[model samples]
Target chain A: MAAEVEVVKNKQVLLKDYVTGFPKESDVIISTENTISLKVPENSSGVLVKNLYLSCDPFMRGLMRKPAPNSRTPLPAYKPASPIYGFVVAKVVDSSHPKFKKDDLVWGLAGWEEYSLITETDLLFKIEHTDVPLSYYTGILGLAGITAYGGFYEVCNPKKGEKVFVSAASGAVGQLVGQFAKLTGCYVVGSAGSKEKVDLLKNKFGFDGAFNYKEEHDLDAALKRHFPQGIDIYFENVGGKMLDAVLLNMNMFGRIAVCGMISQYNLDEPEGVKNLMWLIHKRINMRGYSAAEYYPHYTKFLDLVLPHIREKKITYVEDIAEGLESVPAALAGLFSGRNVGKQVIVVARE
Target chain B: MAAEVEVVKNKQVLLKDYVTGFPKESDVIISTENTISLKVPENSSGVLVKNLYLSCDPFMRGLMRKPAPNSRTPLPAYKPASPIYGFVVAKVVDSSHPKFKKDDLVWGLAGWEEYSLITETDLLFKIEHTDVPLSYYTGILGLAGITAYGGFYEVCNPKKGEKVFVSAASGAVGQLVGQFAKLTGCYVVGSAGSKEKVDLLKNKFGFDGAFNYKEEHDLDAALKRHFPQGIDIYFENVGGKMLDAVLLNMNMFGRIAVCGMISQYNLDEPEGVKNLMWLIHKRINMRGYSAAEYYPHYTKFLDLVLPHIREKKITYVEDIAEGLESVPAALAGLFSGRNVGKQVIVVARE
Candidate 1:
């Protein structure tokens, strides 16, 4: 038998227990007790990855809750005391896998830890272009970019001069959807939680109109004020009252691309959408989709967005926390609209 | 003016006033005061017809309510103390229009009376296939047929062996949608108000399962009992709480084609659907459309269903009243689920 390889301490963010109502930062625990053998085992074809950047995505909230009895979700809950996982930009520290070599850069699903032993095939994509900031692999050049591109062009089917409204406009996916709508010659409006984010949407993101929902007493009146002509396309992020208001103001034959429902994720009972009758009167299509469905179109998505990004015609903003221990707070803040842009964290550096 | 134009009494159903809640028979008046000339004006390109049968549709309730202060409907409210209009089967008494002449048979939007002078050029469809019962023109062969064909085939986008659920499953449109799904080799379930309608759906229309929703206190459990694998297509007719329940049982990538919400039309505040979060979880598409959108495809639709009707491969049922004076009760009964099948009333024999 070969001599045992050197082991190193691995810091991780672990789930404390199953969540109810809103998840608290205390639901996750940062631990430094775990250790890992940094070298790949001779019999395994897996790669040992050092997580460089980990994302705080809204969908991650689902993993903290106990799923409803008799219903099945696409993914399962994170085991108690186990490391939570999400989209990550990583460096392959060691590998026995045919597709990856030591020090190769990649982006895909990984654990919220200092390192991960990834054995699943097709779970990771080799980072192809390295000219841009590597952290972008956590968002714009990855999941967020593909989502906004596919959702706007394929699902909502926007046309020139259409009125597009995006909720959570400063979030990872919302910002890109607004920019994509603009590139398609649309009139865009966005809503966020704070005045600063609202200002970022209008002045920095080039939105035609922006409003802080927290300051507005009536969401319907605010939507009416921003969308005098009614919304032609609604990119849904925050659900509940915002969705109900958007439904009331959708134009004839409108489309709503439902990407996420950050507002409703933490609630014991999500608020009801009351104005769906407008769905019939206006002839709308409200579609819900997973970003994975568009993963196959990554090259096509890059072809459309990469050029505009290179010319500085399209821009992205990210709000990142530092270190692996920061994951819990950064993730919990998403439900409360605490982040200014795409929420991500730098876990480590090469 | 050359001769005193011959005129006759045209007994009609007239709206008493804009309705506030559940419409009553008292909300309409049977009037003998209306008179019509026996001929079309010489200068006009229009037809004067004696109405034979008029359809009692759920959508007619919209015409009863004065629209919201901030909104507009495609059609306006029925004028107080004036004749109401609907889909009608008629005999042309006189015509200056090139498409019709004396003794021509037709079906179109016409006044609920003994006679209608129709000036809208494209409103009428000349009855070309006379082999079937003429009353079929009021239900299966007219707007209901077109609505079912287009909504099921175009909107739901079903494939063989998929599961389908239709609400208000014994009504004019729902019956046809069920039969269409059966003919397409899909497993279908339906919900109706009465046991008689439920029996008709399963034994007559060949639906795989049928349930009286009024008897089921837990719609979600009822749906699960019928569709353990979850619903693939939901043809929404009765909205409100039923819609909320259906949302719970819909399969991933399921499609909901919204037709009418008879249960909601009379409600001052329609029930809010709370399970919309399932839309994101299941990746569903809920689309709402109008029957008018399918009118241009009448010929294509006829080509598909006409042969089935000839071969007795498809069947339709009607709950018809005997005279024009019965129109108010028959139409009002639709909202209460009082009619067993398609509701139609005879206005004249010839």
Candidate 2:
């Protein structure tokens, strides 16, 4: 006879409706009406997990908006009144899959809920090392890290002594890219939203220089001051005005890696990048990429990053919230630059 | 003593002033006052050439405008009341440089005059095979051919059966790019301004299909109808609305080789490309390059294209205007798409 499964109340963060402009905490609802069985269904190749950590990412805001009519890759919209999904770290409570068993810790796409039945086992990656904080899997050890790695090393192909510039420098991917540039013996400068984040980038991350973009009235002048010789590699995170200024200040044969356009995501019409003619004059190569495309190299990226973290040569900062109730505000905080670093919600303690 | 060197009348096309908006024939003056020595200067390494053919390119319009204050590469603006300089095929009347002697055929940058004292002989290429038309060196056998070859094969990295599209389909670079795409076994489509040019693209160039972009009211709908599976490679010669529309119809992992943006050149304010978000969604790589960058590969390019010309696998067309007096009108006609193919001025007959 099969063992009986325990059923318990499951608290979830649900999307109320499609968001327009700036997302608010009221856009999502916290509900405790749902229940989950702490066991994989019989004959089902799935895993049941107790959700521990949920990631708050900028891309989530794009998902909140109604998909474009001709959107080639329309990410499935967050269903109204349903649990919102994102990257999460969880402990497996039960498993019918051959690779996972009870108590196997893992991280991948999951719901903002107390418990989740992960039928898409292919997306989940088993956590190998527990010495580090498990929440690191929600960011530094996961997709954000891969994005920084692939975008900088593979896409930009940074050379020693090259001048590198990164926007949103205090954020998850930007911070890591700055450190990676420093590690490769390149001169690195970063721009952030606040004085505190600027100091963090300079003192903690060991960036060559850091600036508060808000304080500078003219972005072009600020860039000219920082990159007097012009930027060799621009790791683009915040697009729009920043991109326009960067185009004017880019060196001949410069490379721009388009990771995300955070500033343009909320606007009804994206800001016009006026200085694109510079792409021709300077012979610039601008390419856009997603970290999900580099999943096959996840293990390669881990192998490169793990040793640096272990030796304290590299460090990661995360702004974390506690419990399922903090989920809405945590996610909304990303757009307003309310979070200092990688934003994570601790759904439950280990 | 050597035969007394003769001084001769030099007919020159001089820019009356820095132009704004659309260029007019009146903006340039045909000067007969200029005189040239039929001999190379003593103790100088310069080669004097009797100009035969001059090429009319869209980039010359940029040279006619006053240099931008913040321009990174301020291409020495055409001085008011001085003859403009452009690519020319000429006969070496006398030489002090070791590479050339009297009567040697060469093609490179020269003044738009009957005679030019070529001091910058380093950029000039000696005509080895007069078997092909010497005029071919002014275009398909010169910069335009290299631009198409390098931009298409090297930048686009096209694969067999990939969908390819070219804007300015009947113009100098676009015509060659269409032929190159067909050579690679790709499904090729082109966009021109007139029905005659469109027919030339389909019949003469052997493109799979062609469209007159001017007749199409809805650019995006035209792109969608033509590229139902979406464009894998877009050889961007005309920018503005065509680029915006192409962005919407691009397949995942599309590549756009930006050789020129003729549509934006004449406008005081260049049009903004709005659908750039498609870059991130589709993971597109858009690169801007110039033929000058590929000069070192000129020999390799000639080796590939000469055989095609001989075998009739490729052919070229030129809208020829006789004498230097027609230089201004020939140049201004480029902006209006009045020239059918490569526009060349017959400065003198071979």
Candidate 3:
């Protein structure tokens, strides 16, 4: 096995080139010739990690676009000829940093390769609780988890008995938000892209109601039917026309937490929401936030959510593909809604 | 003098046959005979008051629209044949209710006529802190003042050294927000419709910078020039294209308090904001609120602002029309940006 590993070297999938429109599998390529040493560099201030699981998220589509004139987070965050990177659960194979030791399980930004060398020490967090599956760190325990927690609690400021609606209910962050809202004593409903996801939301996540957005001819009517009292808090994972429809149906003083606009990200023109005037009329509070800002609550979150996972009070699902070669398809699957729950690529076995 | 008094019975105006587009002076007609005695019915639990002053706001333009399916406010709030009622400073001539009494000055919703009978006791607040001019209650001492205070301080959560850009600088609410932002140690800038208002913002209201929005060909560039560091708090009094421009110039985690959308109120088709996607990129917070909702804060606001008004620390501007006959033109002026500061109709002198 070591001989075969030595012959093949470390494989990586490059950006190939910056993307346009909907990103195709051809936009990124798997190249096997990239090399990495098993040992950490002498006098280095970096951690050498063996990437085990890589996360696929909708935000990567924005990264694929070359920095436009008005772009804030630039293309340099994902340069061409460099390996693609995202949230990944990894093992510290060797560490030159004093804080981490060999075999320490960590999760953060890592490359789409068998191995990665990271210089940004602050971004890396050492994993502590492992009662849940380690692959969950790539999702429910990592960025996606924090996103659901912060966007729902912090941004929406949910009150008990408030009606909450989540778009993309079967997706990684949306599923967790529905559960969190339920725990908060709020009535929660969710909209998904498929029948399977709709069922999962109601049966597995215990969402108050679930609807397939594709099957619903009128989103406004669908929301009204599901939420007769009107929605107080909207966890906005899907934007575009759904946002417009939701705006029309929102109750007075509604709070909209826009974690991401997945529905609009890959579109050619990105749909325009005509009903924004409703925001003014209804006195809605709409805010967009990133999860990275809520790191202070991570410990408290672990304390609350870990127990739920242990007692089977909460559940998480993942669509995982094996090998670094499957990374491209795993990410592409996110856009098409082909993968239910969180999609993760397993680069190596323990 | 008794015959003149009988001939000069206080009048009210009706919008002429539901006009569309920008309001004109010809849209309203006045009749002195329309008003009844300034008294609540016998044994009734309503408070009847003499409307000493009537408020003319940009929002009234929306009320003038023929009732639509999606109307936010109640229909009787703006009856066509009856006198239009809004925020007014009045003197309780007689009361059948426990909360108010004869000669008590109050700030509340009132008809455009010389008197109004209000059964809704919750809406009226007995005017306190009379050390300031009673007319001040019609402007900086009343609804506009509290709207600015709550929206800027509570909704925006403004920080010291934050950059605050207020649209419609010299208008009723905008003028107060600039002062409040300054009081909070924020650097304030404002956009007005005319050069005089621009000068008034900087010289009178103490805004750090002010611009005539009408003169600026490109509003985004105007915002950039004034707020070189990007705006942290945007007091949005004018929506449509101005809002789109402001979105592009917002800093990360910026807050926009939507007080009113004066620009789009009269249009058949409200303009769409194209750059809304920036809300996600910039992590902006946009919230809309009305002064009525912040009734709990009225005493707190009065206690803070009254002293400032009495001491001349906070100066208010009023465009007063001497008689009810001038009320139509005064109200119409709000939409065209003709009224600088608060537009008020003074029906009588003390």
TM-score of chain A of each: 0.97, 0.98, 0.95
Poorest lDDT segment (10 consecutive residues) of candidate 2 chain B? B68-77
TM-score of each: 0.97, 0.98, 0.93
lDDT digits (tens) for residues B84-193 of candidate 1: 99899999999999889899999989888898899995879999898888899999999999989888999999999999999999999999999999999999999999
Backbone atom clashes (below 3 Å) for every candidate? 0, 0, 0
Query: What is the C-alpha lDDT profile of model 2 across B102-203, one tens digit per residue?
Result: 999999999999999999876799989888888888899977888899999888999999999999989999999999999999999999999999989989
TM-score of 1: 0.97
Best-performing candidate as measured by TM-score: 2
Candidate 1 displacement at residue B125 in angstroms? 1.3
- RMSD of each predicted structure: 1.6, 1.4, 3.5
Scoring model 2 with DockQ, what do you get? 0.65
Candidate 2: which stretches are off by over 4 Å? Answer: none
Q: Per-residue CA lDDT of candidate 3, range B1-350, in tens?
A: 32222222566776666668988887777766664655566677888788787778777787777776654563243555656778788888878888889999898877777777788877788986677777777778777888888888899999999999999889899899999889899999999989889989989999999998888899989998998899999999888889989998999999999888888778787776666777878889999888767779888888888788767778888888888888777877888888888898887755
Looking at model 1, residue A284 earns an lDDT score of 92
Interface RMSD of 3: 2.0
Q: How do these models rank on TM-score, best leading?
A: 2, 1, 3
Candidate 1 on A182-238: residue-level lDDT in tens?
A: 888999999999999999998888999999999999999999998889999999988
